[model samples]
Target: MRTATSIDVVDHDRRRLLRGALAITVAGAAGLLPAYPGVAAGGDAIRPFRVNVPEEDLAELRRRVLATRWPDRETVNDQSQGIPLAKIKPLIAYWGTGYDWRKAEAKLNALPQFMTEIDGVDIHFIHVRSKHPDALPVIITHGWPGSVFENLKVIGPLTDPTAHGGHAEDAFDVIIPSMPGYGFSGKPTDTGWGPDRIARAWAELMKRLGYTRYVAQGGDWGSPVSSAMARLAPAGLLGIHINLPAIVPPEIAAVLAVGGPAPAGLSEKERATFDAFIAAAKMGNRTYAAMMGSRPQTIGYAITDSPAGLAAWMLGHPGFTHWTYDSSDPEKSPDEVLDDVTLYWLTNSAVSSARLYWEYDGGRSPAFAAGEKTAEISLPVAITVFPGESYRAPETWARRAYRNLMYFHEVDKGGHFAAWEQPELFSTELRAAFKPLRAAK
Candidate 1:
């Protein structure tokens, strides 16, 4: 997931009015009301959608790639400056000559993709119903620098556990939505489309889909959204399982913010984790967060226009590639990373996506900020802390953060992009985390 900036909050009432009008327009076009089906005479409709970028569009993307103005090499020998030119050159070469968007499109179209209006934005999602009659419904969200593509690898294993190693009862009917302003989803013209609002939209979305009972799962930005969903505790929200659990305690966050050392009484492991986070922060590795949160629109012009620029911007983030398996190996390929960048480029969502950063405080990481403001999630909460993640919250912090921590485990493999990096492991974690919730409403 990629995030940098947060747009300053605008008036909520005005944004609501605009969304209401959009809802009416969408509803009338589909011969339905903007409200959920059960609540009104005319109900909102979920329409099937296809990913079909015209040939000319693909050609233009290629043309833009070949026409890019090359930049001089950095003064440093390594990534100390940023993504080296050597790393980006081959990626652009493959993107221009070899990569096939059609393959990606076919993969998505093969699944059940749909579009629906939710709080004014047209939410695009893949809804795959499990063959198992008793399969649980789960809405999985993608993070920034990511799209529905991030969760694609796990779709089959999750929805058809029988085909994998699990029994029929472990199946999950998956719902992976492109966040508003990302990928095929409609962008918010006004402000106020942050994770909190997105959570409400998710709740309304599940209800509209006729799913009165469901659980939520996500990592990276997905974690914050899922956390919000759990906090909102919507009717019939079974529980939430997050790989990147945003469970940093507030005192630790305050200390880190001030460049102060870890509090005096922490254990060796807990203190070491906090110390590592502070060290990374001081290294200026997360400057992108400050930039995006403060001035996403300004940076948007460059990223939106330049394909290489967009790719590098994404790669510049630490632990993003580790989201891919064997990311550290020199023999590792850039296929998955290119796929993510291509989606952002084709969608022209550089600026729109960056605006997501503007919704919160500029300096702090979203995970820590999430801890500071979010109320303790009293419902069942499960967490999987992967070793490769930038911040692997100690169990102590997680328990303090989540009032009802049903499950917590430290997986040997995977990273920030856990689900995408290790689908098999990711799927197994979900099956175990939500097993108890299966019997609930």
Candidate 2:
């Protein structure tokens, strides 16, 4: 029953007009009917928003973190029993003593953030327009255990490419949205807010912003949402790029599903991928997924109340649990991870966000859902396979899935959180991936 506090004051005149325009545009889009209660009576408003969490909330979060009951250290050594107390201790210590939520708030407030009602929920997003004229518009979606915070680092590089070792033509108007029930976005009251639904909402969002042609990108849950957008192929959606492209073939899927061995006719890389996937699955690290997908509400009580509990669950979740997949050096520090966890705690979105798993591919590992009912995408598609991903998608599988595959690359490092972990490489990939599609402008 936790509700987000709204700003008391708003620019009545401007927000009213903007909502009117959005309402008019979406009236005809059958799939994007808005049912959310907070929309201005006159229209489907895209209101300008700012992040200003109250002082008491911050104080309460620290109190909870410090007041956490300690759990005994794991019996076995190593991560064999999941993230040991050894890992949790440092994270909790930093969260309680060293972490600063205000700085994170200030960084978020510096960005141009907004909220707009789409398909019965208020969607929060960060929109940064590139200064370069004719900059391609791109919508970047973040996944579970992540928010728009995950994509923050890449904003400067993607929107202002010139300053980040890229030509002006490489710039993009970046849009990072907080999925419904995550971050400042409103939680859904009913079912059906899955990737497909979110994709339609993104299309409506871009149209509201007057983007005639744009590209989409994401990793983790973002991959499925971006893929859904491509399949919808609205008038302006030109292409999509995803790091965790779920491109497993039916044969591989069947083998994995039945706990069977790799099929006889596979190449060396394919066989290796199958083996690695099977091995990763056997580790039994997906207990979080099972809980969230089946009973988000049950777990919500614990995470909503205990900041430490939330951090532990997120830190050890199957979706990119480690600080970084790169073995040499960590791509993200413990502090960065705390910021993300704190945001979730403050918003009380752990349960609501976890509910998204139930909506689509419930309790199933992202790799296990091969031949799922996916919309056929005819638009140009681009994919990047990072070294540290759960399972690298083979080029053969990607080519087979996407009809108009324009670009595909395998980078040296980075895992599930590519944009957050390696903004430079991520920005470079975006520049190259959509280079061909930009000509459509």
Candidate 3:
């Protein structure tokens, strides 16, 4: 439930930073909470990392497909309306015939995975520590229609900087987590798990790892969650970097449109970057946002039932959601688009994943919309603006939320799935954004 539009800016709950990603417990629904017995991220606390895909789970997925009842295509033939059943049957046939769930399961397992109970639900994440002695700690959060799968391509570059032509100093102990209910994490069976709760979860996650300072990076839903972390000002959350911003405001738009003074502590180039971001948001973010906000589950079933349905649900997005290209002529290659969508389909998370929309709806929280004209984030912030992202968050409006924005960049190519599409560009901006703290640590 929203507190009210005009209430004084609220600070995040002042809770002690917990140790270990999932073990930390917080207030849950009705004041109930989950418990983790004495856990730290290292040594004994580090449980064996593996994702067990029970045979029954796979059997259930196949069983559901076999038992699917066909619906006539004329009943809903339109693409924009929902997934066309006519198109879905063939894909489901392929899923039952050719798709290999074990291989998909293995690909995910190759990366060390961990799950901890953060707040009330289980938080599933991938933690890859760089061999580099000075690796920076960074947390990557995925949004709706996305999961750690979206950022898989970028994990290697982030985890091993030298291999990607970057200094080992830029290496990161990267953390990729499936946001509540999107992947392996526990479903938000109840409400109250919004951006603010997620931010707190990230803060606790970082603290559990013994990271006194680190970078927070995200795109899509990740942007606001990271922003909420900045608002919370956890002791170790030194800086925040986002590929997306919640929304741009009129006050900041006026400044960006008119080309006014840059926000305090931002470079002139950063100021111009904000202006371009402001300009882009008005034209691009509307369609995707409107769709994701409403009737997400209606479309969820379509993606769940058919791989082609899922592909169509996702393929057009990077063109519109990322900064790489316009909807008509997307900058990203079709292979790249298919790859991202494939990760979701191969994981068979389409239906369970879509449940996130239903879960959020039950709570009645609109995490994407920025009802406030200006939201002030107290911690240091950095933002990466990609071409196709719904719309850019200008520095003018950004300043109202983040008091200490350390860096900002207008990336050359990439979109909503920045980590996967342009890992180098994504890592570079992250390195630059968190450089100040890196030096201190």
Local distance difference test, each candidate: 0.78, 0.78, 0.60
lDDT of 1 at 428: 95
- Off-target runs (Cα >4 Å) in candidate 1 are 1-43, 321-332, 369-374
**Ten-residue region with minimum lDDT total, candidate 3:** 9-18
In candidate 3, what are the lDDT values of residues 1-441, reduced to their tens digit? 434331112101001111212332322221321222336444424343355445654565566556666655655444444345554455556555655665655667787777677776667788888898978888998876666767776788888878887888888888888887565665554556667788888888777666776878877778767777877778877777887764444444456545564457655644555655554444443344345446655666677676555665664453423222222443343434443455565345554455444434432222232432115566677877786554555655556445566776777777667776677788787777887778764
In candidate 3, stretches whose alpha carbon ends up further than 4 angstroms from where it belongs are: 1-46, 54-96, 251-374, 393-401
Tell me the number of clashing residue pairs for each predicted model: 12, 0, 20
lDDT (Cα, tens digit) per residue for candidate 2, span 1-441: 323323212222223322322222334443433233334445467666666666667777788788889888999986768788877787787778878887888888787777778876778888888889999999999987888888999999998888999999999998899998887787777788888899999888888787788999988888888888888888789999988776778768878877768899888878878887787768866677888988888988888778888888888865556674222553577667777898787777888799988887675665533533332788888999988787888887777777788899999978878888898999999999999988885
- Residue 43 miss distance in model 2 (angstroms): 2.5
Q: lDDT tens string, model 1, 347-378?
A: 77777778888875553576663543445577
| Candidate 2 wrongly placed segments (more than 4 Å) | 1-41, 318-320, 324-331, 368-375
Compute each candidate's TM-score over C-alphas: 0.88, 0.88, 0.68
